[model samples]
Target: MARFVKEIMSPAVVALRPDASLVEAAQLMRAQDVGDVLVAQDGVLLGVITDRDIALRAVAEGLDPLTVSCQSVCTPDPVCVGPEEEITTAQRLMRDHAVRRLPVVDGRGTVGVVTIGDVVQDRDPDSALAHISRATPDL
Candidate 1:
């Protein structure tokens, strides 16, 4: 079992500038096959934008993705965890905040992201979520 967030986090650190258009963010998400991207500037974490944010906050609101900026729709100052934080602590934070993912930060800045699936996979490898988490993403 993994004890720390870094052990199970996806360390890709997909990120974008605040001024980038939502379309650009979506394209990046497609290219990376990720659901979320960190909104940052000068290595400072500003916010997090997720695919759901685009669909619900922008598209559903009739906002033009090509014009709307990522920071405009992102969840600012999101709850974060350190790479060395215990898995249980991360899980608690997620539950408390009702968030499924958390950005892992340290002295080096945003290092990675830890998702509920990661915790599930590490804590219960035989669980359905773990199985789904391990499966290759469908196109």
Candidate 2:
């Protein structure tokens, strides 16, 4: 049997409004124990905001998290994958885009998110992708 994005994707999505403050996004991440949040507007996916983006793009620039909108620092028009797509397809998309996660969407809307960690844990625990996915950030 083939593995699909839906099989390993995290369906409990934590999203932020485009107009939301980066502080709010950060709070959501802390509350959800996640490192990223989807930036959405009226049910439309706008972008992805990662913890790194908040740190590098906003904080490092001395921007006020209370004032910066999620959309302002998010990775806009992010690469996405469908729920039913093969896990390999998601991995390829992640590698090609230089991203660690991909939003999982369908005709209706975003159904979940797939991270390299998810793939590694579910499929190949010994692959290079798994190592990269599990590597500690250089900070």
Candidate 3:
């Protein structure tokens, strides 16, 4: 069987809300040690905000992060992938869009989040592979 995306994704994810302040988002990211957070509202996926978004879009542009909400800086409309999407498709999206993180969703709703590191981990043929083998098949 060919490898799939869900097989290689990280289950532990950090998420946030659109109403969250940029400062709040940054602190949360720092606390979680993650670069981005999946932005959701009422448990539905919306968009994602990253440290880079704050630094490059808000800070560099002289917007006050402490006063601004994640929705203000987050990519208004983010590219998304279903839990069942092909690994090849995901890779293409990341490469073409120049993004590093992607939020994964399933019928039950959001399942986990994946990153470039996740894909690289999948290639490790060890720790990640062990996890991959047990994942529910890609949708």
Candidate 4:
């Protein structure tokens, strides 16, 4: 493992503020072409809103997306990981919680987001066949 999270983590991310409306958050995700958005304020981490979160947590509940704040439905005080932590650490957290995504934070601030897909995609498999079979695998 690397001394820091930069060694085994995605480098890019999408982030939003808890104060943002669901509509605004959705637009940010759309614009970024990402599946989730980190909810934060100032330099502090807050929660996460996944694309699935929008569909299942809000739309399915028949709530007004335009009026609801992402904070209202986001997984607040979300489980997070350090950038320097081992990749397996995050994988375990996801497996235990049955979560698809995790926010990555460093000393400066939020640096990236990791998903079950990213973990499986980035990890080396036992063999080449296994690697190819799961490369870009749908999670």
- Against the hidden reference, what TM-scores do the models get? 0.96, 0.89, 0.81, 0.81
Which pairs, if any, clash in model 2? none
Residues 6-108, candidate 1: write the lDDT tens digits. Answer: 8999999999999999999999999998899999999999999999999999999999999999999999999999999999999999999999899999998
By TM-score, is 1 or 2 better? 1
Ranked candidates, highest TM-score first: 1, 2, 3, 4
Candidates, ranked, lDDT: 1, 2, 3, 4
lDDT tens readout by residue for model 4, 8-126: 56678677778788889888877766778888888788888888888899999999999888988898888888887888889889989888788887788888877766676567456
Query: Highest TM-score: which candidate?
Result: 1
| lDDT (CA) per prediction | 0.96, 0.92, 0.79, 0.78
**Candidate 4 CA-lDDT value:** 0.78
TM-score, cand. 3 vs. native? 0.81
Off by over 4 Å in 2: 126-139
- Model 2 lDDT tens row, 4-63: 999889998789889999999989988877889999988899999999999999999999
Q: Quote the positional error of residue 116 for candidate 4 in Å.
A: 1.3
Q: Using alpha carbons, what is the TM-score of model 4?
A: 0.81
